[model samples]
Target chain A: MRLAALLMLMMAAAATPAAAHAFLERAVPPVGSELATPPGQIVLTFTEGVEPLFSTIEVRDAHGSVPTGKPRLPPDNARQLVIDLPSLPGGEYTVIWHATSVDTHRTEGSYRFTVH
Target chain B: MSDIEIAAAVLRSVHVAALASLFGTLLFMAVALPVGSGTAQVRRSMRRLVLISGLAGLIAGLAWLTVQSAAIAGADSVAMALHVVPTVALRTQFGHWMLLRLFLLVVALFLMRRPGVAIQIALAGVALAVQPLLGHAGAIGGAAGAQLIASEALHLLAAGAWLGGLLPLFLAVGCLSHEMAAATCRGFTPIGLASVLLLAGTAVMQIATLMGGLPGLFGTGYGHVALLKLGLFVVLLSLAVLNRLVLTDRLAATASTRPHMRVSIAAEMVLGALVVVAAAFLASRTPGTHEQPVWPFAWRLDLGVFSDTASWAEPTIALGATAIGLAIAVAGVIWHRIRWPALGMFAAIEIVAIPHLDVLFVAAYPTSFFTSPTEFAATAIAHGARLFAADCAVCHGVEARGDGPAARSLPLPPADLTANHFRAHNDGELYWFISHGFTAPDGETAMAGFSGVLSSEAIWHLIDYLRAHNAGIAMRRTGSWPQPLPMPQFDAQCSGGRIIDLDDLRGRAALIVAVSGDEQVEPRSFDNIGAAVVVVARGIAATPTGATCIASEPQVWTALAIVLGVSLDALAGTQVLVDQDGWMRAAWRPGDAEDWTDPNTLAARLRDIQSHPIAVNMTGAQVHHH
Candidate 1:
């Protein structure tokens, strides 16, 4: 029953509004949430389907240097960009994403998540 | 004229005249020249002319081959010119036919010098027949191509008979006695008349196939030369008529009349030669079909009633003329007086009218993206949204409901984007509006045109967005989203190395659903239920603790959209229920009147799905046991 209520709330939120820009909606680590273990890949979902060819998301260490494999967009989700991260020591990491949606409209944002 | 042009013209004329001479000589010796004391002398004279003409034609054909090779290679070196002969002869249709004709002409010449008249005639006919294979008729495909080639061959033969035989006829008229002259004229009249008729009919067919229509008979250099040739032919026809009806009679009646007859006959021969020269000029230019840049896209006012500006004008004129011609033909038949001439006139009119009618139609209604619009896709809406947001959203609201922040300062509010007014006009008109921008009748600019800014494709995307938005509004208003039931098994890859194969979950009911785009679901809703729950999460796949979560598959999304009976636009927010045994039971969407939010109703629907065992048809809900 509590889960049902949550479903209703999420459905209501989805129905309330939609936007054209590729704003970062959520991430696998849930945007700034600390994880017990670092994820193999960092996934960033957007407001709209982003064109992977023109779009990029880079994971950088605290020093602002790339610390991951090339960003790959899984075909299952056009709106999300997934990049494989190398094994990392416990520290704060930043994801910098610049998305060009299928419409060629460009949007950029950055979010930080920590690994224990 | 350029050197190439001049050479081509000269070679073409020489080749055509020589071929015509060969054809005409054979025809005159067979049909017109009387068998008598002068037959040997006449035969020797004809044989000399035929041999000369055949040799000249072969030389000209070889020269043509070399010149064509040089032109094709874009080189002028003697080596390349010489190289072209075999290349053309081996590669091109024209070269092949020319080679064949040249070879056959050689054999015919050999046969002509001997006593084998029938074989010589057959060889000459074969040489002429090979000619159409060198020209436009050779390029045609299918049954029409065969027909055109046949028609062109006949046309060439008729041309050779009528024009090539002229010199021989004139020579006989001058040298033979008045009695022989009169006899020769009478003998040649029927053959000339038949050849002329054949020539005219075949000319009409070649004109239709090569020129496309009457419009092709104008504007282009080819058209001009053809018109000149056509004029010469008319004069030749008139001369033939005059000679047959008047001059032939005079040849027998008076000595003075014989001189006039000879002079008239000479003039006819000269005109016939000029016509052949004109034909040579015509051949040097591109055929109407291949003359793309010069293909006359002409349209003119028809009978002061129809204009080419109207798309329907050409068809209306053609159909109307045919109807009138047919009516007149039938009337003439019933009256029994003017039927034959009426029928002839109808044929003449069609020959003149039909080919150019298509040209007029094409000119009137040219094809473009505007003429045939592409259907809109969801991606188009996304692209259009971006453009609309960047450009129009300042004046038109973000939602395009038209109350943008900038709209307050304007004299007129921006047009309501959600309104159904856009549905009234066609996509092309809408495109034009976007390109040129909305302009008031009073000459005030409302929305600035994006023609210089956004491409036509971008504008189309904008139009697609508007259309999709309008459809969404209509769907919302209808209070029913038709999502079909009876879900089928499909494949999906899940997060914990688990493949959520729907077919494998047959005996156990599964709540197979997708949470994609903006939609989110309570992942733990199936925690207490006995049924299995698999979430095909697209985008963010943060499932509740107990639920099996899979990354969405393309097939799963497609199958979800279909089985759920939801438009792809609404599929992102839909949930599908598969009954025990893998048959899709039901689907639910947001904004549906059903109380899906209530746990009791959700439980009841799942129980109902379980109770109705066996294969249950979704539409009729008829349960049948295997």
Candidate 2:
């Protein structure tokens, strides 16, 4: 199934179907695109509110699980979800996100990028 | 309803009820006071009916005042000084109107015993006219304010006629002799017509105020309530017509069948009471955000003839319907003394006219209540549940303790909260407390202090959720704090903004921020609040800039700098200049020794000095100096 999924992705279009409840929208980097340099911060946008507690975001490089800072809300606005990434080496990186709002809405998603 | 909302509603209800009782007594006195020479029989009967309604109304006014004590506070009020005003009355809400109304009420009551209907009617009208300006809506300015005052007047008069008219109609049906019944029914025409016109005027004003234009009626909660009121009003009007056309004819045609009119009158009275109850509920629920401004963007409710969008826009010839209404008001005024179809016609007209109002008078609220549904709902529910538990739960319970652990400990066992508390009473009775709250002068029941403990939002939510909770009704409480107001952020202006040192101006005898000896004031000089550099914007004229040193002594500059939190040496470089306005301008760091127009500019210069607002953000965001 993993091989099938990876194989299918090579031929599939870049898109995700809409569903009920809050979900992630655009991420900072084009999800599947290669990048020249790793971003200093990873920001996630959600259609509905997210709980800062359960919701977590992580950036893992080739060396694995680098220490990270707790997600910080932008001083200008709280509703928009955000997370700062740890310093990473030049390698493939994956950003995973998860969280739930008090209203019981839940969401999770992932994207990967490469450093120069 | 939070306490403030309930207090607001309470103050409104108390004023309304007080106004009603005051007006009702006057009307009763007006109709009941005249003695005619021909018949001692008719004179005596009129006097009895007048006395009953007038005094009973005064009692109701007392009831209104009793509920009102919690809303208005402070002693030595005009109400306190008035010998006749009830002990419970808060006289200040009425200002000058109360004295005039009291005099009118007294004269009418006195005249009813003596007989003189014409004198009473005119006086009653005057009393009604004066009470319109003393409501919540009128407190605001502009079109919205005018509509509120107008709507409240109509509302009060309509209520007086509708609710106040009930007592007379009831007596005419059940207890009055055949002559009295006929006379009473006949007397109703003028009162009804006068009442209906004012009601119609008020109805229009209130609709205009709340729903804005008709299109606004659906999107806003105010609009929803408007629709509900319009629907109920139509029903009341139709029944009113039935009383006039169908029932009045039967009763007048034969003396033996007059008993039947009593049943019909009872039904109508019941309906009137039901409407009153609805009015009370209507009063309690918040009026929608005024939709008047949004009319061009949407369509109003479909008039059957005009609703092309809904295809229900069909016009009925309401001319005949309106004729029935106007004939009574005109006939009543033309001859208030005639005992005929005029009174019946007035009731017919009024009942019929209930639905056409535009701006509905409602309490105004800050915009935050409209934008945040979660916070609003939560506040209302929390207030309601807490109030219910305090007031109703003495019988209902904490956790609905009808027979819980704390059941045996109190003066009254608590009522069950979920017992569908909302349905136990209509909006009128619930409004009596849910709007005003229950209070006892002496420390009596634990439930007495609802106004102090819970908010009006909570009371309303409790009411909305509680209405006879015997079965499947669901309830919810919202817990949203409103989103904090967005703080302003100035865009970075300087292309190469950098920290500068203003240390050069320090320790000197006030470095003069000198422009040349010519005068032309720059607009940006308006932003400076610093005392160190006083820009003499050419003092009086721009003829001679003479922008020489108004440089105060160094002691003055340091003191002024200390006062303003400005930097002395902060303006060392980075395009520092003295503008034509003669004020020094420079870019500086945030944590500076001195204050500048923009904090970001000042903090950039400070580099090391710290303050709460800037420091909290800097440490949190982890911004550092290069």
Candidate 3:
């Protein structure tokens, strides 16, 4: 009953216009996952409408050198980007993404994934 | 339209229709559903009215869908009409909600076939519940959004009700008895008054959204259009008030004056429809809610071939840029989650500063291969050649000629690298190989641990070069290979920490070592004879060291030059000052020079400050007291 009261209090707090824009709830590959082979594309699902033009997502190797298709955009103008790697050897790869929503608010993020 | 744009347009258009359809159906139902009780003539007239109004609603929805795509996504006619109609039937995404709305409408229409006003009202109410979800309510999902959405939705419904109610009023006076007309006027007057209030409230909300407040009222397209919308509605409201106050009062006493009041109401309805059209246009515009760019970038592309990617290879961040980016990301996330949008927005804008950081850091390391997407492909093949040697050449022939003596014992066929079929495939297919294996991700898996062991990026690069090699393509890199050039070897040494001349230790082979602040050797060690010239860099030290302490590093390099019997000035074609922290680095360039060789001058200056306080003291030589 005590826990329920706290929950009720939380639920009663309304979402403000500003609070609606949330950062990524969960990034794919669950932040860090070692894959057998490279995935063809990089997908980012945001809490709001992301602007297609001004956003950039890049994949870099351990050496900090961006791959051939480092800062790639979405293939079909979708919210995801597909980076063509010249060759991604087995190593820890860092995916860095920066996006501005249609609302014109900018945000950036980074996550790591390794190739098995 | 490009595929994505086409998709977004189709989506926006169908949704507009779905939203507008609620008002379309409701207005017709309001006008056509009612008739006087216990009369067969009234029932027949009501059915005819129902058929006409329902048909009008259908026509309005079709027209709305046609214009909607053009409004929201700029989709041209025939194709758009074809696209949106089919989309509604598919019931996807926003379309799903529209379909659910349509289902409710069908149920309401079926229930209306059997006429109990209570039953019909219940079904219509249920249908209206789906109306908000058909969209236009999102503007209300958040508190502010809700206020705006509620005002807008009411504006739409109220306008429809006033216009719809007028149709019944006109028909009752023209075709029905005088008693029915009197009853209709009473119902119409209250409904019309309620609509005027809703329209006024909606106008206020739109102005709030577009102009934000007082100052913006005179600025922006949204502001201008809103002002215009408000002006028109004010005129319409005034006409409605005049009809209700003076004209409707006279309608009962003098039947001939009825036309004037009805004309005023019709004019108001026309103006209200114009407002609806403008409001629809406003909805299509970007939310324009936040001052910042909601989404930073508009384009995200991944061509399985990383080669064609925009801004791919070179990252444009500086040394301190990564830290700043990480800091911004963290701070922005924290601020956003905490409901501090203003602070979060500020931190988020720092992303612009971060990309520049990458550009600066990328400049520090030189490229291992030429950066050309096309030219470096041969290099990729060479890289693949190396990769093959490391991973595949054991059972396959070194030349890939298909005759490895050990291949006969293997269950899988050795890779036929020379096969035109394999070489001709796209990067996507080659990736399929690395992803699946030697058995072919297309075939089976055995493929070895190449995919498991090597990064896909390396494998892709290997394939790129291999493809070029297979294509028999060659590109000449003017400087990809090492080219010999003659440049000065400024490795010089100082005698007693002073600039020692090259001629002074000519026979002694004075290796003139240019001492930078960072050098590895002591001043005395340069007195040996070695084949290579030893140059000490004095000025290269990290911090500001006095010349006296720094001069020692060059002195030692000079001694080594004398011992080697080779003039530091005459060492070789290239004076290689630094061999990039490699094995040859310590041998070629050595010693630390962070300290100063000319400390006496500094010491005198310090003494002048400490002892004399404010006065400048002269040194012993400069004073020259006899």
lDDT of 1 at B463: 73
Q: Return the clash pairs for model 1, or none.
A: B213-B355, B213-B356, B214-B356, B483-B565, B484-B565, B487-B584, B506-B581
Tell me how far the alpha carbon of residue B161 in candidate 3 is from the true structure, in angstroms, after superposition. 2.4
Q: Report the number of the highest-DockQ candidate.
A: 3
Scored by lDDT, model 1 comes in at 0.64
Could you give the TM-score of chain B for each candidate, in order?
Answer: 0.54, 0.41, 0.39
Off by over 4 Å in 2: A1-116, B2-45, B72-107, B110-115, B126-131, B141-144, B173-198, B211-226, B290-626
DockQ of each: 0.02, 0.01, 0.03
TM-score of chain A of each: 0.79, 0.70, 0.67
Looking at model 2, give its docking quality level: incorrect
Q: Single out the weakest 10-residue window by summed lDDT for candidate 1 chain B.
A: B617-626
Candidates 1 and 2 compared by lDDT, better number: 1
TM-score of each: 0.47, 0.37, 0.39
Question: Could you give candidate 1's per-residue lDDT for residues B440-548 as a string of tens digits?
Answer: 5677777777889998678877876665555445445553322222343344444564434444466666766567767656654554666777776666655344556
For candidate 2, the per-residue lDDT at B85 reads 36
| Residue lDDT tens for model 2, A50-85 | 445446778777776767787655665433467666
Per-residue lDDT tens digits for candidate 3, residues B1-626, read 24433343344433333333334334434544344563346445554554454344344444544443332333466677566554443422234444554465465556556755455444443433344333334412345555655665576566655654554445454554444444556656666777778866665555445343322333345445566767787787787678667765677566776677567667765675666555544443333222221121122111222243564344323324444645656676676664465455445655554444232111111111112221122233445656766766666676454557677666576777555555434343455465445564455544454667777657765554344333321111221112111111121223332332222232222222344343443333322221122444433542212221222233333322322223445322112221211011111222323222333432332233233222212121111000
